[model samples]
Target: MAEDHRHETHPEIVKRLKRAEGHLRSVVEMIEAGRACLDIAQQLHAVEKAIGQAKKTLIQDHLDHCLDDVVGPLARGQRRAIDEFKEITKYL
Candidate 1:
């Protein structure tokens, strides 16, 4: 497994994830209760958006901490870290 160097955990991210979890539970209930398709779709969309926001927060943290630490002399690990950081935005 890769080591996670982005150590910052914003409270807002935790709150959003908690809300997303509630939304997911509601979605399961909707499925069990045979709710309308559109309503379920809307709830799933909300979960997706929440997850995307969390990912953005994590990427920002990586850039701020891990990437900032690599700005010195060009050691091999530093070069690889810089390359990975530059490419990370594509995943977002």
Candidate 2:
């Protein structure tokens, strides 16, 4: 059987996502209101930055807990976990 290695969503992560959602909604409203291109672009940049920060936090958490456990002294599962983390980093 495959090992189940899902990380539970931390409360702070959820809060950050909620705040991002609000920012996204504002961006949508700005678009609908025919706001200037530069203004909309600025808001989009803010949203992207927030998402990037949140992603970094989540990645750090995974590295600390899941990856550390997988890559510890045994080294048996290290390669696979490392490969997975590399794949995930590509998207970010």
Best by TM-score: 1
Count of clashes, each model: 0, 0
lDDT of 1 by residue, 2-90 (tens): 97443647777888899899999999999999999999999999999998888788777767666667575587875796777667775
Candidates in order have lDDT scores of: 0.81, 0.78
State the TM-score for model 2: 0.66
TM-score of each: 0.69, 0.66
Local error of candidate 1 at residue 46 (angstroms) = 0.2
After superposition on all C-alphas, the RMSD of every candidate to the true structure, in Å, is 5.1, 5.5
Candidate 1, overall lDDT?
0.81
Candidate 1 weakest lDDT stretch, 10 residues: 3-12
- Tens-digit lDDT track for model 2 on 1-92? 99965566566777777878888998999999999989999888888877877887788778767766766665557567676775687566
